[model samples]
Each structure stands twice: as structure tokens, then as C-alpha cells.
Target: MLASWQMREGFLRSGRMATRRGVWVVALALGLAAGASAGEEFEGKLTFEVVSKQAGAQPVAMDYTVKKGLVRMDTKVAGMSNYTIIDPAHKKMSMVMPAQKMVMEMAIGSVEPPAPATAPEIVKTDKTERVTFNVVDATTLTLVKEGEAAGAGAKTYEGQQYAVKVGDRNSEQWIAKDLTLLAGFVETFKAMAQGPNAAWMKRVEWPGFPYRMVTKDAEGNVLSEMTLVAIDTKSPDDTLFTVPDDYKKMTMPQAPPAMPKE
Candidate 1:
């Protein structure tokens, strides 16, 4: 684990731009958090700007709108504009490329994510006050990855993966039970290292979202981070989830490698 952390530290210190492409690895269902709470369900938009320090990496600003099982993400990257609509109810994701005037369709494996452990084993580590543009909410709890201490054998858990070369993963997040997004996000991902290429991948019993998440190499150097900029529960336009009449249907340019006929 020491060697792995050292390598990851070097990587982060180098700021290689190639890794920035992973910004899109967020959950296929970022907006799906059903059965979370009685009053938590509502439609609204979340706008965030993802900035990377990696060389040649261009910052991206995107908006996510959610209504029930539908989600629309409009993105602008490197002067190019495009978007995707994820329909969990039908297990379909639409990729709209305006330059090509085409809409690509792909099927997702699941819409209803695996429910998080009802009695998740929780181990608290640290706590501190967190702020968002002066909206302070200090009810914070930092979680620890049970078992597999640093310099020990590999950390084992369900769906753990290390793509583009693996590295030591020691993560902690500030969780709030009110958000109901942090736990589900963890349970939904790493169901096989499929944690959307982002470091916000660890699962715990916290019932809320993390306004601040920090992942470290074995040595604890910051790798990547995700900050919740805003949350609005107002319902969004229904049309955002629908493909336009003028869009031409096309097969996804890159499909998940087909399962072998076993």
C-alpha cells in the first residue's frame, strides 16, 4: 500500500491531463434517489463546474435536471456542446450530439439500484464544520474504510475495481442524513469498480450527501474531489427528458464490450 500511495501521489503531483476525460464517469443515474424520504422527492436543477488542474484539461460546467426517474445533463466541453438524458424507468440512456444531429441509444443494466445496507456498519473517524458560500452546515461525520488498513493487503469490497492501473484508495466524506444521496451513490457504484471514474466512490451509512469529499493515496494526498454546489427541488420541464422530433436515431459509437456467448 505504501508503494501504491507513492505512485498515486506522484500521479496527482504531475497533473496529467489525460485523466481528466474521466469527469464523465459519474453514475448513470446521478439523479435517481427514490424512496429516500417523504418530502425529499422533487424536480430541480443542479449546476456545477468541474475544474481540473491536470495539464491541458479544460474545465466543464454542466447542469443536471431531474424529474422522477428522468435526468437530463446539458454539458459544454472544449467549446463543444452536447447532452445526455438518462431514463432509469426504461433502462435507456440517450446521447445527443448536436453537431451530428444524432441521438445514440444504449441500454443500462439496471434502473433500480441495489438498496444500501439497511443497517450499514458505520465507523466514525473525524468531524468538522463545512460551508457552502456562507450557508454553513456543520453536522459532519467522516467515515472510515473498514478493514484493510494502509500497508496491509488489498482492500476488499463488493464491486471494487482499478482501471487505468490501480492505486491505493483511502477515502473519507462529510455526510448528512438529510441529503440521502451519499449512501445510494456508494451502493450504486463500485458494484464492480464502476464508480464513474470519480473518487466519490466509497459507500457508508450516512443518509445524506457530501458537500465535500476527499480521496487520498495511501499517504493521504488529495486525488480528486466533488463539491455539491446547489440543489433545487423544483420540478423541471418534462420535455428535457424526451428526444427531439428532428433528432436522427443512431447506434452508440462506443458500446460496452458485448458479453461473450458463454
Candidate 2:
């Protein structure tokens, strides 16, 4: 049986933005809105699908709706539905659990406790590639670099792909040129922009959002993958960003009192 941290590490190894339930929301929010114009606000929905090849890992689908700087993210885990609402204007984030009918709220960019004493070593390699993907339709995308039909007659996004090594895990990230709504939606709701890895992550200066990411172990076995599935420009309803009246709100869990000094 895998310990909780082991499972979490597996998710990280697969190139997830962070650990825990709100990870994807945090990761996708980071650097997402840097390109939008003030006069042209983005109000739409974006969906992503995460697939994990690691043992005991389940696929996850994330749906994000952005409106007037308010963002709502929805996903299901093990048949249970969960939601995260980010109100950047208020600098707050809310986690809604449907089954429990409870909501936990916290300020955005809250600092987490320090990690273990020894930080993992990470390195960026010199390898680079031009990845091309054929947009089959509004909801379909095919990786043309991987031998798809040459005559698909579709629009394509040329991706700047690069590799990075985090300890024993190797990951390849395919970043597409910043698209207005897609980039703006994420940047507006970024929750944890300055974490343990913020310095290193920002140092690279991603010219765009990473559309596809694949992580593999030292022995070259794939552990997980996350891909951009679709982007919907249709405006989402205001109700999707609001908390239901019947749901109870919960406070943050306080730590136990520290032991007496010797």
C-alpha cells in the first residue's frame, strides 16, 4: 500500500502543479491571465483532462468558468464532486464539498509550512522541440508531431516544448503561445503564485501556458499526463460562482498548542 505522501509524490512526479486536492486549481491559476487587455475581459469556460499511468491513480477532469474576475473550478474524485471558487477581487478562495455540504475558505497566496530540510534537486536540460498539434474541432485536438494524419485540414498551435528534471522525475512540457481568454482566466485566479518553487518556476518565464505536460520516472516510465481539452468562449452563468444558501461554512483548522519549552 502506498502512503499518502507517496501517492502525492506520484501526482507531483506526473507534473501536477502542487500537492493536495486544490493543486490543479492553484497550478492552472498561476500565470494564466498575463495577456488579457483591460477593455476585453474574458468570460468563458476552459476544460482540462488529467490522465495518470501510476498505480492506483484515477483520471480527473477539471472545468473552469471565469466571469468578471471571479473563477469557479469543478472536478470529481472517486465519484465525489468538489468545487473551488476563487474571488481574486477579495483575495479569497473557497472549497466546496457537495457531499459534506460544507465550505472552507482561505485567503489566496497563503504561505504553507516549510518543506523538509533537504530540498529536491531540479535541473533543466538543453533539449528542445517544436511540437505541432492539429485542432480537429472545437473540442478535439490531435498531436501532429506524433504521426497524425498530415492532411487533417485543421488549425494548429506550434508548441515550444522543453524538458526538466525534478529529482528522479523527468517531465516534458508543451507550451502554446498565449491565447487571450485561456491565459487571462488562469492569471486572474492564481492562488499560490509564490510558493516553495515560485522562484525557480518564474525564472523560466513561460512565454505561454503549458497545454500539455508529461512526467516520467528515472527509468523512463510515464507516470502521468495533463492536457488542455477545450476552451469555451460562451459566458457562464453567475450562479456557478456563488455559494449555495444551504451550505455551511467552516473555519480553517487550527494547530494544537506547542509543547512546553524544556
Q: Please give each candidate's TM-score.
A: 0.58, 0.65
Q: Write the per-residue lDDT of candidate 1 for residues 11-80, one digit (tens) a residue.
A: 3432222112212322435335432233344356665555554568787766666677566777777998
lDDT of 2 by residue, 25-116 (tens): 44344333332444445677767778999789898987777777677888865786678887655756677766656576655553333332
Error of 2 at 30 (Å): 6.6
- Candidate 1, residue 4: how far the Cα is off, in Å: 46
What are the root-mean-square deviations of the candidates from the true structure over C-alphas? Answer: 14.5, 8.8
> lDDT per prediction?
0.46, 0.57
Candidate 1 ranges with C-alpha deviation above 4 Å: 1-40, 111-123, 133-167, 177-203, 253-262
